[model samples]
Target chain A: MHVIESGNVAAANGVKLARAHVVAAYPITPQTPLTEKLSEFVDAGEMDAEYIPVESEHSALSVCIAASSAGSRPFTATSANGLLYMSEQLHWAAGARLPIVMCVVNRGIGAPWTVWNDQQDAFSQRDAGWVQLFACDHQQIIDTVIQAYAIAETVSIPVMVCYDGYILSHTYMPFEIPDSDTVDGFLPAFSPEYALNPAKPCNLNTVTLPDIRPDVRGDTAPGYMEIRHNLHTDMREALNVIKTVDEKFYSIFGRGGHCFIEPYNCEDAEYIAVCIGSLSYQLRDVVDALRQDRIKIGVCGLRVYRPFPDEAIRETFKSAKGIIVLEKALSYGYEGALYADIKAALYDCDNRPFIHNYILGLGGREIKTQQLLDALRQSCTIDIPVPQWIGLKM
Target chain B: MREDIIQIRWHGRGGQGAITAAKIVASAAFSSGFAGVVMTPTFGTERRGAPVLTSLKISKHKINDLSPITEPDMVVVFDHLLLKEVDVTNGLKEGGIIMINSPRPAADYSYKGMNVFTSDINSVASSVGLPPGIINTGVIGLFAKATGLLDLEPLLQAINIEFEGRNPEKNIEAARLAYENTMIGESR
Candidate 1:
């Protein structure tokens, strides 16, 4: 049914429709409403799930970890500081190969302190071995969460569906909630290959040697390095799984083309703007504005940030004249994290453009479309400064 | 800035339900055949009586931008005092309408040459057994009558859906009364 509600409610409904068996979360700004709505659903007997209200974000993911180990579809969510608290478990969940789904409402990590939106929180955990998905709007937020469970379960890797905090989280927009029965048909039951059972009494992820080692049964098993290698290989394979799941979801729901890199007017354009989350949609207006001024520009929103869609990135920029990447988070002293990653992805491409980076909207700073237009206009001229901080004040 | 979209800015204190009003208006616009309607409320922490604003965009086309609306085509004021506390008039179009809630007639007020329509929305709320400051729903009538942008039936349906079983009759009646009572102003 078509409904007008906040993005948080859309996410909560997606979790409900996916029939998540367990939900564990700690209340954090922006993300708090999502968890609160889940609790309401469980309290109102709408969704049959064990809502475990944990004390901290760390414990929240820990609960999901423990629950998923027993072969339950567990879900959780967090924001900046809360996400930072879950840093250790992020790797643990990914390394353990658990089919856990999480929503990281993107926000800036605290130095002095901020409770607003940014990509820093999620990007900081990019190397944690989990698949990351970014949503541009409320509809994508709901659809991606449903698809996330499918992707995570299929590949046995955790997934983080990231979107801008406050921007999408609080805004009310039109979204269609898919029928529960259809969603059930689309997403299968959660059945892990290996699960911890009390009756069986088996140990998982025990200490491993440097190389191939023998277990108590005298059978050879992959060692620590080998296990790490398998995780990396599965992640690479996950790119295919992501594509399959996207296709499957579209066939079932009729509302998804946002694959690894969802391109907007990029097929025919020369200069393309690349970013993640809602910024991509925001830049679309800029693309239209630029087009009127006779600038051939477009946008490529990186839907899957991790497993880094290197092939798609390279293909999109194969013939483009320049790439203007505007990001919310910076890699501290270096440059924009995604900008650097995009450059790294395009390094091997023989035909490439002068890619430039603009850092904007850190700590909830207001970003105007005019500012973006000016940036894109200058970047079309192809400036030399790598990471120009927009809206800087002494 | 787009010619096709109608941008609306709402001014009210934190507790006056400006956010919910914007949402209901967006829903009403959608029901009134607007293909794309987006509402963005003030994003951070809000305290009671502290000024807050929310903006809604109604368009026949898709709204892909999430940028702030610096200049609005219309402004809805839940409390007249908010005009003093906030710059509600800044960047408002000269020919735009300012649907405001006040006891005085619309002719008594002039807001930077923009059309002003006044309503005693607080009294409308009180007459309907709603608390005095709960004038958000009552001002919707001022919106409908002053702008003539939306049909009253869709708005009433939106209110019914939004306030289902929570005194829907009273809210509907309050909206009807305000619509009948709204006075259009000649810009000063």
Candidate 2:
């Protein structure tokens, strides 16, 4: 049924529908409402889950790790400093192959204390080995949460569904809520391959010996190298599983699978703007306007962040004359992370557009569509500048 | 007429339903078979009690510009204090209308070439025992009475749909009171 709701409430509903057995979270601005709604659900007996109120984000992820190790479907959410605090545990969740799903409300990491939208929080954790998906709107936020759980459980890996902090988190929109019966039919209870119990005691997360070989070990024990290789192979196979699960979700829910990249008006275009998060909605207006004026412009919204979705991105930009990358996160000494990834992905293609990285909306700065169009127009005139700032007062 | 769009700029604080009012107005125009777009141009960080600016565009065709409106055909100020902090009438078009929710006499305010409309929407809202945030609904009624760009019936319908029968009568009463109290066509 269609209902007007906030992004936080929709996300909480997604958690309930996914049938998460354990939810561990720490309160943070823009992310507090999500946890609050979930807490309400737990109190009202709507969700039969263990809601762990941990002291800190670090302990929150630790609790989720323990719960998921016991073969329970675990979930958690944090933002900015909270996510930074849980950085070490993020790797643990991924390396343990424990199918944990987390919602990272993308916020600016502060020295100035800003509780606003930015992708820096999640971008800083890019190398943590967890699948990351960026949602563009509230509906995508809800749908991606459901899909994250399915993908994580299927691959036995953790996944993070990221949305802009205050942009989508606080904005109210009309969204469709799938019935519980439909969600149950789509994401059935998770059945894990291993579980911790007193009856069958086994050491988990043990130290590895360099000289150990798989053949020398018994049938029950796998060598450290074999385990690492298995994890790598599982991640490689997860790409296909991600696509399949999204397809299945769409089959059930009637909305999913715009691929890892959604291409708008790219069929015939000379210049394109690549973006993520809520800014894409604004870009749509610019693209439509430019197209009417006979300016060949297009837009590409990147959904999947980890595993990077390189193949789809390269194909999407093959026909463009120039590419403008709008990023909400800045890499200290380096250019925007998404721009760097896209450049690396399309380095070998002939006649590749001059890729420009524009860092805008950092520390909660507002980004209007006209600024995006201005950047695109500038890209056509001069060589696309590196780390250009949009909407800056200077 | 080139059928050009009439862009409206709304100024209000967070939690005052300014964004909601813009959306409802746009939805009402769209429901009446006109094209419209509503957007919030937010900056820095927004918290409750902080000022916010939201814009709405009603066009005969699709809205093409997504930029902040520097000059607006109409300006709706939800708070009287905003006039001192920011120039609410800065880019108001000639003969444009400025609707403010203030108890002071409309003649007391100065507008060089624009028409000024004033109402005590908060008073009307309080009289109906409605929350102050519902002042937007009253402003929408004033907007309808002054501009005639949107039909009051469709706006009330949109409000009913949005509230889902919760406090609809109070909102309708507020709208009717605002419509009755608003004085338009006064040049200052």
Candidate 3:
């Protein structure tokens, strides 16, 4: 049924349709509404999941990790400080190879305290070995959440579906809620090979020495280093899994499948604006306006961050003369993290475009359509400087 | 002619349901054949009695812009008291529509370059036996009447969907009363 709803509500419906066995989270701004909706679903008996309200985000993720390790599909959500608080458990969940799905409503990190939209919160957790997927709108939020579960379970790795807080979370849009039977057809039940069962009694994650050890049967087994290596291998496999799951979803529902990075009007273009989240929705207008003036410029919204869609990045911008990366997070003294990744991806190209990074809209700064056009006009002149902060104070 | 995309800003207190009004208005616009409708609120910890601002953007196609509406085509003030506290007229487009929940005649209020419309939403709310404090939905009716951007039945439907309880009938009646009573003010 098509109903007008907020992104948080769409996300909660995604969890309900997926029939997540364990829903655990700490109530935080933006993200609080998502979990609250889930709690309502559980209370109304609309969903048959155990909704665990934990004391802190740390406990929230730990609950998910425990539930998933015990053979149940678990889900959790947080933003900014809450995600930071659970950083330790973030690594543990991936290390345990638990197929847990988490929604990180991206918010600006605090010192001055802002509860607005930004990608920094989720970007900070890039090294945690979890697949990061960013959605551009509320519909993508719903579609991605369902796909995240399938991808996570397939690779035995956790996935974090991140969308801009308040911008997407609080915004209302009309989206079709996929029926549970259709969702089940796309995503089957979880059946783990190994679990925390006393009848089968096996010590999971026992202390392994640095050196490779031989088993009781005299077979050489993987060491701690090998375990980490396997995690890396799985991360690589997730690239394919992400695409496959998105394709499966598109087949079921008429909407998804262009999963990794969404390229808009990039073909036959000389310049491209690289960005993520709802801001990209606005940039499309800038691109269209510029196109009317006959400036061949386009935009590519980076959807999946972790198993960084390097190939897609290269393929999309290979024809462009200049690639401008618009990011909401800064790496302190260095360029934006996305800028570094894009540059690295295109390093081997013989005719690499001048990749420039512009850190804009940090701390929820409003990015006007004219400002974007002005930046694009300035970028047209070669030798554009890196880390050009949009609407920055002196 | 109507714009390809319509931008509206809401001025109200924290407890006045400006966010709720924005969402319902966006939903109403979507149901009225605008394929894209986005409603957003000012992000922060909202407290009752504090100033709150919300925005709604409606387009015929998919809306690409996510920024707050800086230059609004229309502005709705849920509480007339907000006029003194905030510059409710700031960044309003030329000949923009301004709807306020005031008992005074629209002719009595004048902005330098805009059309001001007035309706006594509080009176309508009370006439419909709604609680004394809740006048947000009533103001929305005034908005629909003043702008004519959305159809009356869809706006009423959106309100009913939002308030899916025993009092939907009353809320719909209150909206109808406010719609019938809205008055157009002079643009100086």
Candidate 4:
């Protein structure tokens, strides 16, 4: 059924369709509405899920971890500081290789404090071993959440379905809600190979020694090295899983075959602008304007941010004359995190495009279309230079 | 006449339901005929009565521009007091419109080159027996009548959805009352 609602509401509906076993989250701006909708669904008996109202983001994810470990398909969401508070648990969730799905409503992290939109929150957590997928619109917000669950369970890695906080979360738009029966057909029940067997009583994630260790049965158990190695191996394998799940979703629902990257007019473009989350959608209008101005430019919104989709990125931009890497998160003394990754991704290309990076929209700064136009126009005309800041007062 | 995307900027205090009003219009426009409607509340400080703004963009096709609407087709002022504090029509397009909520008639307020419409929404709120704090719904009626951008039935329907349990009839009545009272003023 199609309805006009907030992106948060769309995400909540996605969770409802996914049939999350446990819903735990703390209230935060932009993300608050999403949490409230889940609680409403639970309270009204619409969704048969354990609605755990946690005290903090840490407890929220902790509840999800416990639920996921207990063989439940658990879910949680937060933004900025809340996500930061769950930093340790993030590693625990990923390192343990639990199939937990989280919605990281992207927001600016606080030093001075902001409740607005940015990709910094999720971008800063890039190395946490979670499969991060970004959404550009309300449709993608719901679709990605459902797809996240499928991807997470397939490979047993936590998934963060990231969308810009206020930009997508609070805005109201039209999106079709996939029917429950078809959704069930698309995603099977949570049948994990490993779970906390309460009756058998074995501690999961016990302290592993540096080298190979043995259990009470005198069998060689995977030590710390093998554990990390397995996780690393599975994460790389998840790229294909991401593709298969997206195909399954499309087969059932008839939309969203764009799994790794969503490309717009990039098939034969000279300059391709790249970014994550909703900024990439906003850049589309700018690309349209540039097309009118007789410039062959397109936009590539990198949906899967980790396991880093390097091969896909390389193939998409190899034939382009220039590549503009526009991002919201800066590595603080270096360039944009995505800029560095895309730059590294191009090294394997036989004829690499001249890549440029523009760091913009940190802490909810406005990135107007005109600014995007000028930036891409410069990247198309001017030589590659150091990372520049868009809309900088100085 | 610009017929592609009708972008409207809403100006009101933080707690006065400016964003809520924008969302209602977006909902109404979507159900009425338009294929795309997006309501974005400018995210920032939300202390009550502090100036807050939001924008509603409705298009015949999908809207890809998520940037704040700098060049709006119309500006809806939920509080006339905001007019004195800020230039409510800063980047309004040529031949754009303005709708204001005040006790004064439509002629009392005017902006250069823009058709101004004003209605006594506070009085409409009282006469319609709306809550003391519920003036935003009344302003929607004025917005609908002045702009003719949306139909009355869907506007009231959207209000019914927004105020579903909290006396939706009162809001519907307020919208109807203000819609009857609104009129376009001469633009100089």
Model 1 lDDT per residue over A148-196, tens place: 9999999999999998998899888899999999999999888888788
Please give the C-alpha DockQ score of model 4: 0.58
**Stretches > 4 Å off in candidate 4:** B1-3
Single out the weakest 10-residue window by summed lDDT for candidate 2 chain A. A211-220
Question: Model 3 - which docking category?
Answer: medium
lDDT of 1 at A104: 93
After TM-score superposition, what is the CA distance of residue A59 in candidate 3 from its true location, in Å?
A: 1.0
TM-score of candidate 1 on Cα atoms, chains taken together: 0.98
Pairs of colliding residues, candidate 1: none
lDDT of 2 by residue, A1-394 (tens): 7544567878998999998989999999889999999999999999999899999999999999999999999889999999999999999998899899999999999888888878999999998889988888778888899989889999998999999876777655556788999888888898888899989888887876655544434444556776777777888788888899989988888897685887778888788899887777668777877777688988888998886888788888877788888899988898999999999988988877788889999988777666777777777678845999998997
The iRMS of the candidates, in order, is 1.2, 5.8, 3.3, 3.2
lDDT per residue (tens digit) for residues B77-121 in model 3: 987888999998889999999999998888989798899998999
TM-score-wise, the better of 3 and 4 is: 3
Candidate 2 residue-wise lDDT, B137-177, digit = tens:
88888878877887899988887776675788888788888
Deviation from truth (RMSD, Å), model 3: 1.6
Q: Write down the TM-score of every candidate.
A: 0.98, 0.87, 0.97, 0.97
Rate residue A73 of model 2 by lDDT: 90
Ten-residue region with minimum lDDT total, candidate 1 chain A: A381-390
Candidate 4: residue A257 Cα off by (Å): 1.0
Best by DockQ: 1
lDDT for model 2 comes to: 0.82
